[model samples]
Target: MSKPITKTNNWVLGLTGGIGCGKTAVSNMLEELDVTVVDADIIARQVVAPNSDGLNAIIEYFGQNILLPDGTLNRAELRSKIFTNNENKEWLNALLHPLIRLKILTDLNNATSAYVVLVAPLLFENNLDKYCNRTLLIDVPIATQIERTAKRDNTSIEQVKSIIAAQMPRNEKQQKADDILNNDRNLSLVHTELVVLHKNYLQYALQNTTNAP
Candidate 1:
């Protein structure tokens, strides 16, 4: 479903998919085509940088174990902790999500490309489609997701399945997408579909960009 954005210049494309669905590859391709991408994963890291308020909040709650020798957040340790302990995960989300949302809005407002792609793994789950003009879902089979993620992350298929099960299911995502990128095949096919979406986004942006009153 499409949401009404009051600003025309900030036309946002909320791009999302399941784990190991090649969202990184698709975002890179869109970037190569000159689309500005405000990625949630990248923002998530930035919010907890060494001296930030978000980091301080995290340390106060999770303690020093969440940090590395170099003062960066210990992402692996946090991932393990949160995945294993539901309470820890919920507490962390309570602390970080508001900060992340504020940063995302600032980034989107500052974007200079024809249109922006806000790449997020949990776009739908977080109800972030509210910030977007359209939602783009990249579709891939679960077996493929398990295979690719396990291979790329050097983890087991079971671990990948656990991660996938924790997310919004593939069918639910497909149903919510305003536009779908069928990415079950090779890069060439993905690129072909992306090019078409690129054109569509450009036209949408141009049509929606309003002159100042």
Candidate 2:
């Protein structure tokens, strides 16, 4: 089990899964029920948006070739760079993780719903689950992941596999999760499961509120 780096008053439900594991679908259902979801992927992009401090720092490290003609981060180029070099990946993570974490925490703090859902693909890999009251893993088979991601992203199987390789494995995520939802079925079935989880989260939030000092 990972230890939390910071304690928060909000009842945070850490939601995660492997690439293409239907995390967005689950988070959307929760949103329909009025749950506030803080998405780390969005924050990750925001931190590196054009002209931002994060982008400036990245450019300082990687030079002009890291940007597109539009002056935006060349994500594919950066991905290829880091994928081939462990040291570069580590350096990049060291630079960006703190910025991303800070933004995630800020958004979570501002959320007004009964509970906040912190949706992060790298939740366990980055140890972000330590901030949650409980963690939920959306699990699907590796075949499903590759198929879904390649279809959705219009990417090659090898590219999808590489992305999966970069993520924490399904078994490892399962071992760390407080709850797991199998997402191999259709959206309707997945939503049904989520409804139950939503109710449980609401009840847990109420309990936490009642128990607060």
CA shift of 3, model 2, Å: 20
**In candidate 2, what are the lDDT values of residues 159-191, reduced to their tens digit?**
999889988878899999999999999889988
> Estimated TM-score per prediction?
0.90, 0.90
lDDT of 1 by residue, 98-187 (tens): 888888888898999989999999999998888898999988899999999999999998889899999998999999999989788989
Specify the poorest-scoring 10-residue window by lDDT in model 1: 1-10
Off by over 4 Å in 2: 1-5, 85-87
Q: What is the C-alpha RMSD of each candidate to the true structure, in Å?
A: 4.2, 3.7
| lDDT by candidate, in order shown | 0.90, 0.92
Checking candidate 2 for backbone clashes, the offending pairs are none
Error of 2 at 44 (Å): 0.6
Q: Identify the leading candidate in terms of lDDT.
A: 2
TM-score of 1: 0.90
